[model samples]
Target: MEQDTNQNKVSKADSIRVKLYWRMAVMLLVIIVGILAMLAVIVTQGWSVYKRQSAWALASQKQAVWGLVNDARFKLEEVSNMQTELQVNLDPVFGSYIGAGSDFDQLKDRFGKNKGQFNASLKEIETQIKALRGTNGDFAKLGAAVRRDFNQYDRDTNKLLNAGDSGEDAVPYEQIEQDMVRTKKSLSALKARLDQERKAMGEVKALTIEDMARTLSILVGVIVVVIAALILISMFMIQNFTANMIKPLHESVRHARALAAGDLTRKLNFQPNRIITENSEIGSLCLSLQSMSEHLNAMLRQVDGSTQRVNLTSKEIRTSSR
Candidate 1:
């Protein structure tokens, strides 16, 4: 019976040890999961912030580029409008010079007075044209060629007007027409080119916005997924740990109650499935409990033996007295 009691106590100690290891394992798992979750949250937050900053930077760059393109377009439009006004004024001037007859000198004088204004307008146009040319490579070469032709036409017209005897007949109208046509064609080409550039700038801005948005969205998704996964893992670990700890405690409570009820025949049955690598307070407690149980059982046996001897003595005393 004593051997069985000792075996039961050993079994109970082993069981407590196994439960202790399981509880510790669960706790460690929870801690690891918690750490991983925290790391995921930090990483995801950092990544999201980075993506947003990058997107803002890209947007700023695109805005700057578009601003330049808009400025170029505005300059080109100003030049085109000036050229149209000049063409309108030149038509009547040309007709008057051709039909002036004997009053040609009077007309020529009038033309001379207006010439200053014309020259000023032409200079302004040329300046703006140069600005347009410098803005882009395609516009530069075309604008230079057009300006050269316009200059030649101006020279020819001035020379004809200055000659007193030669009259307006000396003016090469055909050449003027050809130069004007070329100028119009060049202006149209420049306008078209500017429009194309503006369009391209807009498209680039759109693409940049789209790419930035995509990056931000992807980063957000990653962050969410990581956080969710970490949460679930943590919950699972916590639940597992709770079960391990609670089951062992409940069993220990039951065993303790049974022992308290004076059931000396009843003993705790436990199994240790884990090894102890170091001395622990819990290990010492278990060892102490085992020792206490052994001592209690020994004391109980001595009491039983004493009671039997006292009964035997009492019966002998009674027979001698009779």
Candidate 2:
């Protein structure tokens, strides 16, 4: 019987006591948990953004290099086209030198004008290629090669034009043209290389964009998960606290009210087999209310009995006198 009694006894807990310690501790724990969680999120997101921004800066640099390469290619095309016009004017200049086709001064002036324009384009290529090399170490070797090729081409073409200026007799046209043929070959190679680099940069830019998009999606998902977890945890904890403390206190108030209204017969705990255990402040209050009700009921019963006896005594005296 003793073992059964012990087994059936309600458990004791000191949580939700009159002291403020337990509630304060819960509040502090919640605050610390929230702050720590937010800090972790901020650190993680900040690092990711920093890395992505670095990549974007690198891409912008690549774009600058690409633009330079492309501009060099355009200038090369212009120089090549102008060379054809120089070729067309070559015959008239030679005829003028022989005293036959056109005025010598007019022919020379036209050829010189075209040559000046061609040289302008060559200078632009030189500047743009140098810019490409200076922009980044990766482009340095290619830029040097293009510059070397263009220098050789420029020298050879100038030699040919100077030979023409000397006279038809001094011009070794075929030999100079042969040497000049290889002049443009270097530029063609550079153009091909620029094409390849442009394609590669495009691919890298696309990949970077995709990576940033993926990281953004992951961050959003992590934030949503953290928020949802916090909300659910808070709800569960609040419900437990209400049940253990708030509900019990509310029940104690109702019991006290009934006693004050002379309803001493009403039970503190109306459950058939359950009793409010005196394990915390709320339970202690219910116990005190029960005690108060019992004493008041006893006093009221004594007063009622006395009143009935006095009335019976008065009626007996009246009957005897009659």
Candidate 3:
């Protein structure tokens, strides 16, 4: 019986330990899950920020390219206007060079200098357009077309300048105008494509940032729920452990105190058979107290019997002496 009681006690202790271990494991799992969720959220948010920054940078590049395109377009328009002015005045200048013969060389030199500057400007514009071409395939194609048109325009401008330098009457006004129109349209197309890309990039950035915020919010909510659950479960376990272990030990202490005061009449009433047989040290202690009380009761009964016999014997002797 004692061995069985010991085993039962061991079992109850093991049961409590198991409960504690399981609860601790559950809390650990919750903590780990919360940490992993937070890490995932951080990584996701970081990636979103990176993507947004990249998109913004690309949009800025596109805007800059658009400005360069406009600049090129204006340069082309200026070249076209200069060609028209030259065409209108070149014939009269050539006639005056032949008739007046004075200051003719100076006039030719000034016109040559102006033509050189215009050609240099056209070359610079071409270089900038080529630089923008590799940024987008469609832009490249449009830029190539623009380059072809501008090349033709440059050729016409050269032809007009050459005719004036040689005192010739022929000019390419019609061809120059056609080339200018095509160049303008191509520049417009390039700008339109850049604008479209920039707008799309902006939209993508907005959507990515919004999604990151939403996901972070949800993770935060999950963390809050996990923390709350951990707190609640901890409180419940504490209450249960205190009630089952501490309360029983306290009850055993009270019973032992009663036995210590020589109150053998007072029962060690650990109600509910399960509480007494719970394989706990407190239960065993309560049982020992009960056994002690039973032994004390038997001893008291024997002492009372002895006292009664002594009193009856003394009464008989007194009567016999009388």
Best by TM-score: 3
Q: Itemize residue pairs with steric clashes in candidate 1.
A: 11-270, 12-270, 14-271, 14-272, 15-270, 15-271
Cα RMSD of all models vs. native, in order, equals: 9.5, 8.6, 6.4
Report how far residue 54 has shifted in candidate 2, in Å: 5.8
Residue-wise C-alpha lDDT for candidate 1, range 140-196, written one tens digit per residue: 665465456556655665655543345444554566556556655654555565556
- Per-candidate TM-score against the hidden true structure: 0.47, 0.57, 0.63
Off by over 4 Å in 1: 1-187, 190-220, 264-266, 269-280, 312-322
Candidate 3, which segments miss by more than 4 Å at Cα? 1-19, 40-57, 89-136, 151-173, 197-220, 265-322
> How do the candidates rank by TM-score, highest first?
3, 2, 1
RMSD to native, candidate 2:
8.6
Best by lDDT: 3
Top-down lDDT ranking: 3, 2, 1
In candidate 3, residue 233 scores what lDDT? Answer: 73
Better lDDT candidate (2, 3):
3
Error of model 2, residue 208, in angstroms = 3.8
The lDDT of each candidate is 0.53, 0.58, 0.63
Q: How does candidate 1 fare on TM-score?
A: 0.47
